[model samples]
Target chain A: MRGGTAVSIAYQTLRLSDLPGLRAAIRSGDYVKHTAGLGAGHLQTNLAILPEAYALDFMRYCQRNPKPCPLVGVSDTGDPMMRTLGRDIDIRTDVPAYNIYLDGKLADSVTDITDIWRDDMVAFALGCSFTFERALEEAGVPQWHIDHDTTVPMFRSNIETVPAGPFGGKMVVSMRMIAPERIDEVREISRRFPLAHGAPVHIGDPEGLGIADLSRPDWGDPAEIEPGKTPVFWACGVTPQVAIERAGVPLCITHKPGHMLVTDISETAEVPVLNPKHH
Target chain B: MRGGTAVSIAYQTLRLSDLPGLRAAIRSGDYVKHTAGLGAGHLQTNLAILPEAYALDFMRYCQRNPKPCPLVGVSDTGDPMMRTLGRDIDIRTDVPAYNIYLDGKLADSVTDITDIWRDDMVAFALGCSFTFERALEEAGVPQWHIDHDTTVPMFRSNIETVPAGPFGGKMVVSMRMIAPERIDEVREISRRFPLAHGAPVHIGDPEGLGIADLSRPDWGDPAEIEPGKTPVFWACGVTPQVAIERAGVPLCITHKPGHMLVTDISETAEVPVLNPKHH
Candidate 1:
């Protein structure tokens, strides 16, 4: 809200404390726009819902490749209620947008999936890069995409994700232009949020990850690398989406890019440290 | 060898560097005993093998309850090899002892499982308490069970585990007597090994976890608490065993209580810090 150019769609000037109200609006179909600054300071997530047949493999896929798919919450089979993520959070209609895929191809994008929700389906919410992006911004790091009103540039890389079942493909990475001097500071800050794709996978050369052309990204608009700025890459949530496509599951549902599931968990909630002495 | 009374069975003096040789000796049936001090500085694991029918649920079960079941390695379905754990490791023959369970009942204890190895079976190696115990010992913490040449006392606690499919039961914990003054130091040291059950789940009162008597443990011999000592409880690997029992799977195989699967991974190996700066 402070730095980025606002989108054309009208959104209420909401504060971090107004998350429940915002979510209610999203559920009522009153707000179908991308959720960026609406629920500021709260954790927003990427959504992936699959059938029971594919649930185990996809869960394993996430476990093996945590950098790309840091699982924040998983719903029980056939249960639309994601109690672990938030109160009254129904997977069938919580998100603003959902992309339904059939046989590895996108069939339709819908605002509500209550009609198509299946008893054999399971929903998984993954930590989105937005969590760390917010952290970086709060720490005074500049984000070029937010400065201009554009999506962050993302590209496919040569790094192959650890395969699980039918899910295996080259990792997808989101690129950000940062001054070389701030690399270490950014790394340290980002490393603390393991659920939000912890740290940058590649800091310097895009070519090192087999990325030939920076201007031509696989997804999102390309951002120019200003002089003295280095292109830093982080494992993207899209990596799992691509893997899901490759797996060719009969039916899959995901959040439309930029449309996320906002949760009650605060972005600054202390990552659960295992301490027996206190318990 | 230094603190505990030695077992009567003669074991050739083996050093940290003698892991491969010791594992080979164990595989050849030359050694069949507790693996606490053997292969020092290396990771030792508790094994759990289940049929594919229950594999997904069990994996999910472990994921939900990480403290009791810190998964270190999971083999592909029908595969006898654990490629990630160690070189030339065969799940069928590597371990010195295996407990075969039939429908929640102990069926038999065997030296080798090659005869019962099934194409539908999946092998999982969970991080054992031994890894952090080694860390504690290295940090000058005294383990009374090890000092007395007895197994650490284990008890079933009243705390229920987060259920996954058919796997849900009260958590199992192993008790250790520590000086009240050294509790903080021990907690700090053990917390570093997340893969090794990390820190204690409970610190002082045994009855807080519904444990009535410290001297009357459900399993393993009990150690007398010395003056100025407090009981510390860690989530035990035996947790999964109890859950599996409650699950009542048709066929499940696990490692014999103390006999573990020794891996090539060093106990002090940096627990895979996800640093994208290098890659």
Candidate 2:
């Protein structure tokens, strides 16, 4: 299984443009691994599934804190199909892995959730930072964490998200070290992808976000701040997980940390500008 | 009363920056008039109130159809205080007038909704075109409707808004005639206010939107399309009103056509960018 996972990861990296094929591999359980660089030009989303009772308040929380939770697609109540996101994506089995939470505590991880599917479940697909990370890589901006083949370091920041019902907690952010010269270019490029956590929440001074040490992080790997490099922070998708823990709902489901749901929508697809003439 | 209303309208035109004083006048029934140019640099919003049972669906509708319904602020259930919009905005009495809709039919127009405020009701304040209109006026583009002291002509368009649940209908657009050369500048200026209906949905042909005659509009008085001036259309705030009517909810409340809720936020107030460094 380990060798099979490694081979599948290599294959996925080579066929970055084949979204449907990649999704198929993920759905079939043949490629059960992180989807960091799988769908290069396509949008990858963080998943959150909650019962209909908690759906409204959670939606409000996303609305209030859009930077951390840019919602790309939402499924109808009790519906497993995400029609707006892809041609035939099933929420229950599309992702490589899903983390099942019982009363906000991790109960188990599973490849398929069909057994736990409920009549009142609502799935939310949120934009992930990988979309903008690809954009940055395309524009020649180097990412230290990616180069080192390690997960991006994430930290819980001092900044508090606007409270909506039980979904309120300090925001979580991911750090990337970049040369000072490329900071402006990176900011400009990222701002275009507002749906994917556009722009840096902080460019320098980790202490500003209440982080005492650059070497210590709440999640993922520790990044080295090389000479002439500055630390840049962006709102992380893990934020919803933090909120979910605080909410302590009876049952909640989410994609594993780095494992994501790949959608058919292009990362560069201009946020739908409704032009009557074109229609 | 007619003379007093006229005097208050003129008074409001002069005291554009005084939002609180203006709201006081509106609350007192001293200014029962259109709020086109009332709050010059401040943001004016279109109001919609719905029962909690229908709130989630209505919010989903707005999320799916953001062009016509860019939500600026949402109130907690049964809470009339719009804390985010202004210092002391009471949803019940801040607007100059309210339109009561009972089962999709116009029941009556009232000056205050204090008597009808429900514990299960939720209020939503949506971005109005007035914010971008002020930007256009500031940028030296003449709005013929405002110049003539008349309402902007609104029409029902062929463009169907992306629906959610029971809320589904064709979009409503407000038309403004612009000189051919200034069309580019107007588009650029208006694009800055994405929250305020963003850019024109149609630039030249009224027939494209299914409007056969410019002189006959579904709502508001007609404006003459001056020679060499092309007709430009923008998504109107009234699109939600049409959806509310189509949904046929038992009871709904909205600001009477041109009567809006004046908020204290500046028109140019940069959309809150979550920067941890700044905090």
Write down the TM-score of every candidate. 0.87, 0.89
State the lDDT of candidate 2 residue by residue for A1-279, as single tens digits.
Answer: 112356555665544347877787788776677888777577889999999999888987887677789877788888998766777889999998999999999999998999999999999999999889988988888887887778899999998887778898999999999899999999888877778887788889999899999899999999887878999999889999999988999999999988899887788764432223332
Which is the leading candidate under TM-score? 2
Backbone clash pairs for candidate 2 read none
Best by DockQ: 2
Q: For all the predictions, what are the DockQ values?
A: 0.27, 0.29
Where does candidate 1 clash, by residue pair? A201-B276, A276-B200
Fnat per model, in the order shown: 0.14, 0.05
Question: Per-residue alpha-carbon lDDT of model 1 for A131-238, expressed as tens digits?
Answer: 888889888999988777678999999897877789999999999999988999998888767678878988888899999999999999878878889999998999
Global CA lDDT of candidate 1, please? 0.82
Chain A only, candidate 1, TM-score: 0.93
Regions of model 2 farther than 4 Å from truth: A1-9, A12-16, A181-185, A270-279, B1-9, B12-16, B181-185, B269-279
Q: B1-279, model 2: which lDDT tens digit per residue? A: 112356565774544346777888888776777776667478888999999999888887887677789877788888898866776889999998899999988899998999999999989889999888888888888888878777889999998887789998999999999999999999888877767988788889888889999988899889988888999999999999999999998999999988899887778754422222332
